[model samples]
Target: MKVFGFAGWSGSGKTTLIEQVIPEITRRGLKVSVIKHAHHGFDIDKPGKDSWRHREAGASEILLISDERWVLMHELRGEPEPDLDAQLARLSPCDLVLVEGFKAVQIPKLEVHRPAVGKPLQYQDNPAIVAIATDVPLDAPLPRLDINDPAAVAAFILQHQGLI
Candidate 1:
């Protein structure tokens, strides 16, 4: 799968841009998957859910299936947090995979930036950032995009991955 990343500071519109672009990319009939990285703890399974109970009961892996979908939860009891590559390997195959965050990892990526926050740009020296999506005017060396233009962003990704 062709992997790309969306990275930026808090409230810089990374998620917003991705949300807009996903459906358009999918509409083009390409299989796309997304991986969103969260720094804080999050829970998809509630305490009383059967999957949660199974996990609490020490099942290392729990598989829940139905007619429409299936969910597999792998408990990380004592293992170190896996890196982006390992995490990507676990996902189902797709024509393209858009990963959000993991800014330090080397990959083709778009740096979502909003200068209103007065933060410095991440792509100033980060070659991994192949393009930038921002709400401000920038004279940076790399390609710049308007954060609200989802079609343009999708076009850049598709072209970069040769999916067009």
Candidate 2:
């Protein structure tokens, strides 16, 4: 699968942009998947739930299935967190994978920037950033895109990936 990324500081609207771009790409009939990196502890399974209890009871991994969908939760336990390549390998086949965070990983990425956030641009040193999406205009060496324009962002991604 062709992997692309969205990287930016907190409050830069990475999630919001990806949320919009997903449907735009899906509308074009390309299967897409996403991996979001969380900096803090998070949980999809709630306490006292069967799946949660299974993990609490020392299950290394839990596969929960319903009529609609299934989820596999793997516990790292003492193991180190998996790197980008390993995580990507676990995903089912798709035409594209939109990665959020993992800024240090070497992959084609669009830096979502918001000047209001008062953060410095990352692409200055990060060669992996092939394009940028921002709410306000800024001179950049890479292609600049309107942060609010999901269609344009999707188009940039497609073109960058050579899918257009």
Candidate 3:
């Protein structure tokens, strides 16, 4: 499956843009999966939940199932966190994988930038950033896209991935 990414500082709207872009791309008959990286500890299960208990009890992994859905939770247990490649392998095959972070990973990506965020543009130093989406006009060698336009952003990603 092809992979693309959205990289930016926090509050630059990476998650919001992805939330809009996913449906836009899916409407074109493509299957999409997302792999988001978080800097802080996060949990998908509640503290008092059975899945949480299983992991707390030293279960390396927990597979919870029901008629509605199924979820698999894997505990690192002091092991190094899995890298991008390892995380990608865990996802079912799809037409495209939209990675929401892992800025250090070498992947074709668009930088979601908002000048209001007061962070410098990453594309200048990151070869992996092929273009940028911004809320205001900006000058750069790479293509500049309107950050609020999900259709345009989705098109850019599709074209970048040769899915168009």
**For each candidate, what is the lDDT?**
0.89, 0.94, 0.94
Which scores better on lDDT, 1 or 2?
2
RMSD of each: 1.2, 0.7, 0.8
lDDT of 3 at 152: 99
Q: Which candidate, 1 or 2, would have the higher TM-score against the true structure?
A: 2
lDDT per residue (tens digit) for residues 17-81 in model 1? 99999998999998999988888777788999889998999999999899999878777898877
> Best candidate, TM-score-wise?
2
TM-scores of the candidates are 0.94, 0.98, 0.97
- lDDT (Cα, tens digit) per residue for candidate 3, span 1-164: 99999999999999999999999999999999999999999988999887888888899999999999888888888999999999999999999999988989999999999988999999978999999999888889999999999999999999999999
lDDT of 2 by residue, 1-164 (tens): 99999999999999999999999999999999999999877899999999999999999999999899999999998999899999999999999999998989999999999989999999988999999999887888889999999999999999999888
What residue pairs are clashing in model 2?
none
Colliding residue pairs in candidate 3: none
Which ranking of candidates, highest TM-score first? 2, 3, 1
